[model samples]
Target chain A: MICEEMQERISELMDAELDDNESIPVHRHLSECQTCRSFFTSCQKMREAVQSIPYEDKRADYYETKKEWWRNYVRVPLPAAAVFILLFITGLIGTSMYLLQSDDPYVSGEHRIIYISEYPEIEIHLLTDRE
Target chain B: MDPSIIQKLRNGNEEARTEFYKQYRQQIYVYCYQLLGNRSDAEDTAQETFIKIFNGINSLQTAAAFRSWVYKIARNESFQLIRKKRPVALSHKLEYLEKDSVENLIESEDNARIVRNAIDTLKPEFREVILLREYHHLSYKEIADVMKTTTSAVKTKIFRARKSLLKKLSPYFGGI
Candidate 1:
């Protein structure tokens, strides 16, 4: 494998996670390349340093816990309010459109009744039936 | 439970919030400590990471992708801390120059502190890989999972990170 290819797999090799075939080339490279050997050594040192140091936080859990209260009480409410505002605006727009289009006399001109004249015979028959 | 806690949290369950914190708090803290190189900054950054998690976790969509989500937050917080010029507090930064500290820690001829301080000086990319490997003990696949990259990419970075660390620490190691 090329140096670049070998270098890329070296980390995995260090972790002993590389596949056997993949590890072979990197192993060969490290044996021959002084720079790669130093690189490998540094990786080991860095791992030790990280491992030895305690990862504990000195801060109390309660201090971190308090933010949850604020998240629940305040932060969550803000998004809800924003959604409410958007919905209210949409409702108003929809209502205005409905009112403007409706046949209601208040919003639109009055509906006029159309008078149609039937033939004289038909008109007489309708009067007779009504009588 | 399973990763479905993410769904419950999204639905506004309070218990899920506590569980979420309990689940990943230390891991994130460790990730932060590894990146920030100090306890105080790591603590602050870890808290900040959770806040982002709390606010944005609902939109994350994939419950299985939670690991990467947290790492992204940790990585961002780390770079932000570093950019803020907060000196990385190294427990071992000075031991190399002083003879006594070295003698005490190097009972068997180990350059442990030398490596630690050198790591602290690495650029964020290099430092991040080392931290993921060393501090988190993440396998290549898991590191790849968090990084949103291939396993090979993670490997290359770890190697490059190591190389950079060696170069940076060479003076302290008295020429590696």
Candidate 2:
């Protein structure tokens, strides 16, 4: 194979991604071509040199700080949200009960007349049995 | 991807979350470091990666895909920071190094820095492929998953990336 084709296959050769039949020509080219061989060798050395850099593994502090942040963010609003929901449900229930037991025309209950209007001749009634 | 840890994390277990962070933070940091070529940027990216992972872990369909998923997040986060900086020097340096002998370079701390500089000069696409394949030792299929591309595409990209790296480093290697 030509150097260009072998060059294209170099990474696969290094990574062993190429099957044996596919790699044979590339390997043969590398053995014969000094330039391609040097290129491949440099690539390997570069990978090693890059990988050898010692990265600091001290991330415990960052993890702790982030964990605390997430906790505070989530913890503070949860109980407040629960209380708000509870209050809303209680208010809903109270309003429903009041409406159900009231002597308004829509409530369907025994009533005593509380007020009578003159012009429109409308009567307002209150539920005496509700108490 | 421990199933029990995943279950606990899904169940909103704090300790499990912490354990998960401890388990994967180093690898993620190394991935970020290799991609970004800077310690501070890697740390920030890693932090953001974990936060995204924790917040979105519930949406992950299976525990087995955790590594690739987390890597995807790290790649995205690193790219975001890189875009913000918009370092013009990297591309210019790559252009300049195209005329130099990178292969003849020696392996010293200084040469390591040069190698890192060479890597940093790569476009994000090529740089990520090189880092994932060379430094992280991710499989082609795993890299495809992280990159959301096909395994063939990953292989091709890695090949091209290594070729580009070889060209960039060849000048330093002297007459080769």
Candidate 3:
């Protein structure tokens, strides 16, 4: 095997991302293993090379312009939200007014509520007719 | 991040928000620049990332998660731009070109440039996980959170990224 598991552990250990307890096995393995030792060395070199690329902060003014986009100039979602709330409130009022004033049988409650007992059983009425 | 800063952020304090921005701007810019391989795309992506993070600040649950959260936003934003502008990103690759040997140029500034080119050739998934670990100094667990994957997955991706970089660089200078 390539001491692969320990090599992975060594990567974390090199970065000090592992606590001492978790690092114990890695240390023990590195002490006894050469493959992982070389892996660790290469990882360090790689880190150095990658970190050497200095950060470039280009167009600070342009970046400033891009900032606070949500707070100031959200042209679409804000208007969409306002439209949503307005539609919701309008729908609520329309439904309420329809319930109160319209002549729709369901919404206006103008239809009479007939209890089941108010209707004579069709079977009984049919028997009476036959008799 | 300090808990007090998080609290200030929650309270929508402008100074705290600026503090948060200052803390991350360099890291975010560098990460975006390296990933997108261009200043314009990098700047646009970084700005969109900050906008997303600040706009979604309320959803962050803890102070400790802030670093990974910022990275997650940056990673997503960078990849989104890459997906939209694949040709632009693809043309930017300068990996493994015939150049001065890094071993000879070890003490020179060009070594960093060579290493950077090497990293650029990596496939984005491998490139990202390795950058998060090596360049960003994020822990395996933190990277897992940012990548939305298990730590084992992160370890595997990083290991593969290193091998991939080595394969590219070895052609020129016998590998790191």
Candidate 4:
């Protein structure tokens, strides 16, 4: 196969994804071609380098950290929700008390004399019990 | 993943949740670290992934599929962070390697840095496939499930991703 075609197959070949039928020709080509062989070899090396990189293992505290995370997950919203509910109740109570205590005619239980007509000869008064 | 642990997790057992976190944390963190290319980001992403997994555990239909399911969460979380950060550039020098250079590169710390940079240079899709397939040793089908793609598509992506990395690292590998 030409280099372009081999380029596509090279990865599959390295991954061992190719079946014997497909891999045999590619292996033959690599043996005969220096460029393809070099590229394939480099790809393998890169894979190995990636796989061998050293990384710190911080998983020792993962369980403890996860516990804290869960705690915060539950703790944060609960208090906030409670505060919100408490504020809502307080606001409702405050508004109800204000409405009950206010002297406004609409809400207050009081008697008032409303004048219907004020004329020189006639006068009429209506008593309203706003309770 | 044990079925009883999953059952306990579903039943809101905190100890089971902790055990689940302990079981998968390292692998998940390593997966994230490989994908994100930084310790801090990997840690944050892994933490978020676990939170998501626990929060959504009740939605899981089967315990046998927990590995795939958890990996799917990790991949999503890592992708989200990658999108948010969007590293500016991923560049590395390409130079020819001497004979027996692959062993030398594996032994040297600098080679590790080079590999990490090369991986970061890849597009997120390619990076995900490579990390899942190579570093995590996940099967093509498992990667497909995590990526929500076809197994054939995953294989194709892995091939393409390897090709891309090979091109980028040609300098280090003797200009191949």
Candidate 5:
């Protein structure tokens, strides 16, 4: 194969994506061609250099930055927050209205439980009416 | 990833998620840095990527490749940010970052500087394939999954990226 065709196989060989049988031809081509051999070497060197770019791990920085990002960007959206607030307000108003409407709250002399507007009956013989 | 950690993450355990953040933060940040070519943007994108990862942990299946899943979320988040910020302001940011990068290249050796320059000259798509294949050492299948492209496309991109780099470095290694 010409150098152009072998270059493709050389890439596969470099990546180890080729089987032994497939790589043999590319290897033979490299052995026979100086230009192709140099090309392969250059590719390998470039790959190594790119990978060798050091990755510094500042754990504290990463932690702080991640927390900051979450605080700044990952919070609830404005629309969602608005929806949540609306739901909360609706619930508050509902409970307030129910409590306000609690006129006959079954004020019993025996039971010590508080039921607001529920069980709307003045227990029997309780309060004595004082009328 | 251990099955227990995956389980914990799926259960929304913050510590387990933090563990994953510690493990992949550098890699994800480097990827975003190289792709976006800005430290500030890369940091923001990487952190948001983790948030998306934790938020979508349930999408990870037991049989799936965990790293691929992580990269897919990261890639999507990065692209979303890019789309959101696709204004003239972005080009200005990139130009400034390029200047910063150029200053650092002077401190590196000639060969390293040449390689960096060659890599930077590549289109972002090709550069990503090279970084994924060489730096990250991801399999073509995994890269395809992360990129949402076919393995054939990944292979083609890697080849073209190598070719581009070789042409750019021909001054030093001129046999090609």
Candidate 6:
């Protein structure tokens, strides 16, 4: 009869779950027991076959579907935020321009006078005949 | 936009509902296919799964867990299908080795086919543990979560399932 310890450790050995210290006993048991060795080989094969099932880049489609679903169901409208931002920027610019043009009495009123423009005097000649 | 649409849907927004279908239909279809192992049953289950997800989202306690929740629904639907089908019993009579066909050789095509068939014939409980462990690469804890069992239980189940599968495959591979 196969030892329970050996049977339990056989699959673990194939899976490499047994530590190096633990593997010695499994290796010795497999060397001595033909049945257990065969079991180990088949276990390895089964693991390989299952692993070969092709994770298949399933992520591509999964990501696409997630994106599509989010776009349709969970997405929020950002147009309002964009509009608010635009209005805030416009108001800031308008206020800045108004401040720049407004006369600041504290910094102004120094008289380094340049010549002001003089309008031409219209000397109208009366009708000579009436003189 | 969809909250408006969702509000409309609550008030009978056919358009918003249509949008929901357009969005999730493919994912549901693929997930169903993965679970059911065939296209036709998957298509039906996918439709049903979506309907449940839609009608029941309000009752959900956590939105972040929705994928697992939806998977749970699909898994249940697939199990129901399996129950209804109640597949035929396997034929295990060893009729092949009787023939003088030199068919028992190690590494023969017949051996591989037999091993494959054996794997296919494994009880669903064992099969699922193997699949979740090897194919899905789930850790013991994660599998326990999916299977609704404790981590130690999952580990024991996986160990046992692998042992059983190896036993079934050993004869074909020429037991040393």
Provide interface RMSD per model, one decimal.
4.5, 3.7, 3.6, 3.6, 3.5, 7.5
Candidate 1 fraction of reference contacts recovered: 0.39
Interface RMSD for candidate number 3?
A: 3.6
DockQ winner between 2 and 6, please give it: 2
What tens-digit string does per-residue lDDT give for candidate 6 at B23-116? Answer: 6566556545545555667767765666665555555555444444655676777767756765521121123323222334344655445554
Reference-based TM-score of each model = 0.59, 0.69, 0.69, 0.62, 0.71, 0.47
Off by over 4 Å in 3: A58-131, B91-109, B170-176
Please give, for every candidate in the order listed, the TM-score of chain B alone compared with the true chain B: 0.68, 0.76, 0.82, 0.75, 0.84, 0.56
Best-to-worst order by TM-score is 5, 3, 2, 4, 1, 6
Model 4: which docking level applies?
acceptable
Q: Tens-digit lDDT track for model 4 on A19-97?
A: 8999988988889999888878777888898887776566546556435567555323335668999999999999999
Global fold similarity of model 1 (TM-score):
0.59
Q: Which ten residues in a row have the lowest lDDT in candidate 2 chain B?
A: B100-109
| TM-score between model 5 and native | 0.71
B1-176, model 5: which lDDT tens digit per residue?
78788887776666776677768878888777766666777777887888787667777775358988887777887788778778854786567557745445545566665566667767888888998899888888899999989988998899998888777666655646
The predicted structure with the larger TM-score, 2 or 5, is 5
For candidate 4, report its TM-score: 0.62
First chain TM-score, candidate 3:
0.46
User: What residue runs in model 6 are displaced by over 4 Å at the alpha carbon?
Assistant: A13-34, A53-131, B1-35, B43-74, B80-116
- Model 1, B1-176: lDDT tens digits are 26778777676567888788788888888787776656877878877887777777667867766777678878887778777774433334444335443334444444555455455557767777787887777777768877778987887787777667656655543234
Model 3: residue A84 alpha-carbon error in angstroms: 14
Model 1 residue A87 CA deviation (Å) reads 7.6
Model 5, range A1-131, lDDT digits (tens) per residue? 57878888888889888989999888888899997898889888778778766544454274755443443434453467789999999999998777766544443333244344766564433333322
Which residue pairs of candidate 6 clash? B9-B13
TM-score of chain B of 1: 0.68
lDDT of each: 0.68, 0.75, 0.73, 0.75, 0.75, 0.59
- B1-176 per-residue lDDT for model 3 (tens digits): 89898887766666777778778887898888877777878877877887787667778988899899889889889889889988755654533233443444455656667777667557878878877877788988899998899988887788778778766666443543
